[model samples]
Structure formats: C-alpha cells, structure tokens
Target: MIYSFKILQRYQLSKVILVVLLLIVLVVGAVPGYITGKWSWKNTPRITNFKDLRQIREEGLTISDLPTISHQKIRIADHNWLLQKVKQDNQSVILLLLTPNGPKDKPQVEWMDINGFNRWKTDSHQRVKFTVKIAGNGNGTTDSEKQSSNIEARFFRGWTNQQTYAVMQWYAWPGGGSPETGDWFWKDRSAMISKKRVPWVAVNILLPVEPLADIDPYLPQVKSIGEKIQASLMKEAFK
Candidate 1:
C-alpha cells in the first residue's frame, strides 16, 4: 500500500509540473500577441495632411499614444524627427530608422512628404547642387580617428521641385577641404514626372551610411539601413 501511495503521489507531482509548464507557455505566447494587437489598434496620421500633423507634434504626444482608425496609426511621427522625415514649410521629409540587416531592436517607422512643402523650389537641377562638407579627417589613420570619420549618415527629406523633380545626392568632405558633393539626380517616379507637377516634394532617404563612398567594410549594417530607409519611403509613398 505504501509503495502504491508513493507512485500515486509521484504521478500527481508529474501532472502538476505539466500543468505549470502549460500555463507558462500559454502566458508567454498570449502576452506578445496581446501587446501587438493593442499597438496595432492605435490610429496613425497619414502624410496627405500636415496641418493636422503639426497639431499632433505641437500637442507633444508620441505616435503610440494616439487612437487607431481602421488598424492604421493616425499619429505617425517617430522619435528621430531630424532623421525621421520631420517637415518644415512645404518640403516633404524622410527618415531612415535602422540599417544593419541584422535584427533591429529599435522601432522602425517610415514616412514621406511630397512636393516642396517648405523648401526652396528650383526649376533647374543645375542650380540645386551644393557642397556638404563633413568636418573630420578621412585619412583612416588611427582606429579611433577612422571610426570618427566613418559617419553612418542619415538625411531628412526635402525637395527643390515638385515630387517629379526630387533629387538624391551623396557627398563627403574632409576636415578642412571643400565638400565633394556627388551627383544629384531626380528620384521621382516616372509617373510623377509625366504628370507635370511643380513645387513637387518627394521624401526619400538614403538609410544611414549606405550611400557614403568607400563603404565596403560597413556593408550589411550600412546597406541594410539604407535599404530599410528606401523601403520605408516607398512604402509610405504607396500608402
């Protein structure tokens, strides 16, 4: 009888352990989905209107705090405003969130503005090229110096022409030298170009460090960021 009782007690303990394990799994699985669903339910702002967005920014609420409309976020502003396509005047903005192809722990949100919402509108592309000098040594001398010079650059978006005349350029400058601004080309989709739009602002971004010259060692991460930025811009445009 004693042996039988012991075996029964052991079976009970085993059953308890299984129950506990099952409970843990259920909790663990449910928590993330619940949180994600909650997050998805919030409203995010669409870029089609900026006066409303300006109000949201001035109101000082983060995007996550807003209510949702049809599962789309109504307040789309991100923390990296300068890097996240914050607009001024009539210029469109672009933000490159993360680049390294590896898992990004940071939240990624892509936004764009079309038409020179608040930027200098130029008719000719030739007049738009300007120098952008980075104030550091690019000699690749010391490891620290090299790292300092190795800028993982990201840009906010603006345009000189309408969305049809958007330009994308990359440049670099040594500490005390003239800025070596690279070629600037229209980045607008051909459809916009065919539409004859003026004061066009198409927000685009070269994700952090992807467009910088001499950037083989900084691949994967740098390239990934650039690709993400580009993808984000395209996604926003489509939306």
Candidate 2:
C-alpha cells in the first residue's frame, strides 16, 4: 500500500512538471511575435465591382461621357487590363485600370515596363519624370487611412508612336500609393505590423501633349487630374 501511494505521488509530480514546461515554452515562443506584431491579425476586404468606370468619378472630372474611341480588355504579361478613355477638362485622357481578377492574379509594376510597352507596340520613350502629391482629407478615422489619403504619385513625359503624353502611374491602395512594386512590398510589410491589409490597383493615366512644347507647362493640368483620379478611386472603389 505504501509503495502504491509513492508511485501515485510521483505521477502527480511529473504531470505538474510537464504542464509547467509547456507553459514556459508557450510564453517563450509567443512573446517575441506578440511584441513584434508578427502574429497580428489583419482584415483584408475584397474590392468588388470596380470594372465599372462610370461609378468612379471625381467632382470636376467627367468620365465615359464623351464619345468612346476604344473600350476593351487587353491582356499584358498574363494579366488582363481594362483600357478605357475619359474626358477631363474637355481633353480626352487614356486610363488603364489593372485589378486582380482572381486569387491567383498577382499584379506587378514591371508588367508595364519597357518590354511590356513593346508588347503593346506603344513605342514609349520616357522623358521627364516627376512626382505629384495628393493631399489627404485629414478626416481618416484610422492612422492607415490618414497616411494613405496623403500620398505621392509618379508622373513622366513619354513619347508613343502617335503622340507625346504626360503619363502618371502608380499602384494605389487603400493605405496609400506606391510608384513601384518594391515600394509596395515594404509598405505592405509595415502595414502587416500595424495589423492592416492593403489591396492595390495599378493606375495609368495619359494626357496628350503637343509635340515640341515644353512638358513643364502641362504639369499643372497633369497634377490636378492625377489628384482627382486618386481621390476618386479612394472614395469610390475602396469603400
């Protein structure tokens, strides 16, 4: 009877030691992740029905109301893009909207680089490059929204086979705008730490410029139109 009692006590002590070891391991493993926010949970809401250009508009910009020259879906680098035109300030502007079509669709900024331009036969030759700043509404209820509201877009002057245009392009997200895919990667990593998910769309805007004219003269109009488009996308599609 005494031997049986000793055995039972040993079993109980072993169980208690095992439980303590497990708890220690759990704390050691979880504390660093928690401190670094590597284990943070973020909500990524899918943006839907964004293909309708009519639904996307800024206060002073008129979209798709003018005569449509070309409205079609063109494939580039294994991804499909919506190529359409909008009238801004009575000038026809070409807008290229690229969105993720499915779970497997991963969009990259390199898709629109020189080789991609060659594929489209645009014969694009990039010239002056600059950045446009879009002011935030300052009414964002969250930090991410506020930061994203005030973002910068990249613009450039480029020559196509037909004409010269002031082109502005960026990968826009609910959290902000990235001029390059690499910029988006770092922003996304930081956002993950902040427990935020940023889904993005590639936006390309082209405004016609007269040949032999200085591009500096056309920058104001490009900035105005670019700001409106970014703001409109944030207001409409992101919601």
Candidate 3:
C-alpha cells in the first residue's frame, strides 16, 4: 500500500535489496490476515444440526407447539417498527410459536430492538409471544435491495407481560452460506451491496426460553431447524 520512490533515491540500495525488502513487507502484512481468517473460520460454531434434534417430539414438543405463518401489508404509518432486517419490504411474514415454561425452566427474555428503536408502540398483534426479526447487517442493506450472499440471521428472546417467545430468524440466500460471526469467508459476501445476496424468506424458529438451560447451548438444534426450513425455501425459490 505504501508507494515509495524517494526512499530508494536516498538509500541507493541495490535492486536485489529493494525487491527483498518489498517482499518482506508484503509477506508481513499478509500473514496476519490469513491466520486470522483461518482461526475465525475454524472457531465459528456450526450451531445447526438437524440430525441431533430428532427427539424434539419425545421431549413433549410437537409442530402444534409452533405458530403458523402469517403475512401483513405494511401500513404507511408503521414503517418505524419494521423488523430491522426485513424492513425494506412492503409486507412482512411472521412465523410465531410458543411453549410451556415449566417450574424448572422459566422464560428469560431480552425483548427486541430494531434500527436502534424498541418495537413496543408499533406492536400490533400478539399471535405468539415472540416476534422473529431479520435484522439489518449494519452496512445498510435493506430488504428492498437484491442480495447474493448466503444467510445472516439471529434470535431475539422477548416477552409481552408474562408470556415470552424465542424469536429466531435469518436472511435466506438462494446460494447458501452461513453468516454467523466466525464465518469470515462471508465477510466479503455481505460487505458490498452489489455482491450482497438477499432472499425474501426469513427462517424463524420459536422456542420456550428456559431458565435451567440457555438457548445458546441448544443452538445446534436451533440451527438444524433453520437449515431445513432454509433448504426447503431455497429449493422452491431457485426452482
């Protein structure tokens, strides 16, 4: 990055020395970045594994525990509270569900915030306690723009009064890729709007927020569900 001609003018260094010095600078600058990327990629948790959660039914869980899909046209006045990631669209689709919090596992919710704004006033309906939100990726890529990257999504646990819901969601790309933090390969894919990959489907998985166990530990199960949903959507979309 540093272009220098005058530095060589004063040193009178031989061409061989200049070449070696330049190589050293380039190698020194490049190694750290390469190592960092490798480390990040290796450490990123693969939170989704559908195979492990086959017992979800045996654990007193059923599809009926989940909410069905619903879509609504966005009213002009309700723009302020659009789910941060899915906001650019004229309509929003929500998949909501709820489960019992037995005495052993009470729900601990960290409500939701969107575009630096809390979503209390604009909350219109309460079908399920949790509201899945597809949040924006800080770079300002909205639901309005087209994207080419894989997926970027997360969960927001929250409650309305005593009822709580675990809101899981992510951006679904036609070409699949994981957007979680240690997946540094996607750092480039999501960085630019021109290369950004966006799909309309947001994979949502709602579960009870159990106090005895953190939802994070079950992320692999959570991820599995999202992946299945994402795969089905991708197949239908690309077809």
Candidate 4:
C-alpha cells in the first residue's frame, strides 16, 4: 500500500509538472503577441487585384472616375485614396475610397481626425447620426448567425466646404464590415495570433444636400448607395 501511494503521488506530481509547462509555453507565446498588438501597427496585406473604378458596376447604377484634384488637396504621403462618382436613377454621390498605403497608415483615424476636419473646413454641428444596415445571405438559422450576417455602418450629416452633405462610412472586411475601429483592431489581433493576414478598405460616401433641404428625406437613398458600394467592394475589390 505504501508503494502504491508513492506511485500515485509520483503520477500526480508528473501531471502537475506537465500542466505547469504547458501554461509557461502559452504565456511565453501570448506575451509577445500582446505586446506587439498593443504597440506596433501591422502593414495591410497588399491587394494584387484592386479593381479599376470603371470595372466595378452594380445592377442599376453607373460608376465613373472623378477628378482627384479636390479630394487630393490635402493628401498625405502615407495614405492612398480614390474618388469616384456613382449614379443611380436620377441621384448621384461621390464615393471616397481610402486604404492603408504603408505600415503606419490608419485611414479610419485619419478621416476622423479633428485637424483633418478643420483643414477641410467641415462644420462642427452634426445634423443627424444614424446607422445603415447591410444584411448578407447566410444559411445559418441561429440568432447569432443572423446578427453576424448584418453589418451596421456609421452615418452622419456634416457641412464641408459650405455644403451640407449626408456622409456614410465603414471599414470593409472580407465577409462584412463595421463602423467601429475597435472591431477591426480585435480582428487584426486575432489574425496576427493565427499568423494570417486580413485586408480591409475604408469607404466614405458623400451626398450633397440642397439648400434648405431636409436630410431625413434622403436617408434611404444614401443607405441604398452605401450598401451598393460596400457590396461592390466585397465582391470586386476585397475578394
């Protein structure tokens, strides 16, 4: 019985050592990742097949390249962007596509920067703030699945260059997108942990509001165009 007790004790001790070793390995692996994610910015994966503006088309809409002079007035060397005009029915909008051009580029923050806003002369008053929902067709029937199928984009109204405009923006991922930068940060961290690369694009849609016009009347149109632009990005640009 004494011998058996000794054997049992040895077994338990070995098991404990094994568990401790595993925990040490996990910590060692995770510590570097945590530090890297917290302090360093990862370069966006290169997109080899970024589609041309003329090559992208929605069912009932028309797209054409716009002169970049107005949009490029305050260009940053590390930021890359494209401007295009999209027309649907009798309505039209300017689509601004911003993406990371270097390791340090943060397109989301760049556009949201107060200094950049001031340079553009964007008014401080926001007429409205809302979200635009983009739903994807998924086979899952669960609530979580349904929720994942839907992406909410950020929208607001601001006056830039003395023109009131309806603005919508989001960061486009492979399957969907989110307006919150935190979502992208978490996703990129996960990708880093898995040794994978995920590409993203920042999209902005601008629709001019006529003088004395109510923006509420144009929300639907803006949402529709935003959805179309996102869908096109997912299908063509980010695929």
Task: Please provide, for model 3 over 1-239, each residue's C-alpha lDDT reduced to its tens digit, 9 standing for 90 to 100.
Answer: 13467776556667778889756755554455467684322333232322222222122122212332332322222221122112112422234211111212111221232212224122212221111223233556576432333455565554444444445554344454332323433332242213222323223454444533344554555554555455444333422
lDDT by residue (15-71, candidate 2, tens digit) is: 999999766755664566778785432233333444432343221223323444556
lDDT, each prediction? 0.29, 0.59, 0.36, 0.56
Q: Compared with the true structure, what per-residue lDDT tens digits does model 4 show for residues 1-239?
A: 99999999999999999999767755654676577684222333433443332233222223223222233312443444555565556556676666554443433574564236434434323322333233345665555433222456766666655677777777776666777777776666556544544566676777888853566677788766766666556545554
Task: Give stretches of model 2 more than 4 Å off.
Answer: 1-70, 103-107, 111-115, 118-148, 193-196
> What pairs collide in candidate 2?
none
| Candidate with more favorable, higher TM-score: 2 or 4 | 2
Task: State, as a TM-score between 0 and 1, how close model 1 is to the true structure.
Answer: 0.21
Count of steric clashes across candidates, in order: 29, 0, 10, 0
| Candidate 1 Cα outliers beyond 4 Å, as residue runs | 1-81, 84-215
Off-target runs (Cα >4 Å) in candidate 4 are 1-78, 103-108, 113-149
Better of 1 and 2 by TM-score: 2
Number of the candidate with higher TM-score, 3 or 4: 4
Instruction: Write down the worst ten-residue block by lDDT for model 2.
Output: 56-65
Which structure among the candidates has the greatest lDDT?
Answer: 2
Candidate 3 local Cα displacement, residue 42, angstroms: 42
How many residue-pair clashes does candidate 1 contain?
29
The predictions' CA RMSDs to the true structure, in order, are: 21.7, 15.5, 19.3, 12.2
Position 30, candidate 3: lDDT: 49
Q: Cα lDDT of model 2 overall? A: 0.59
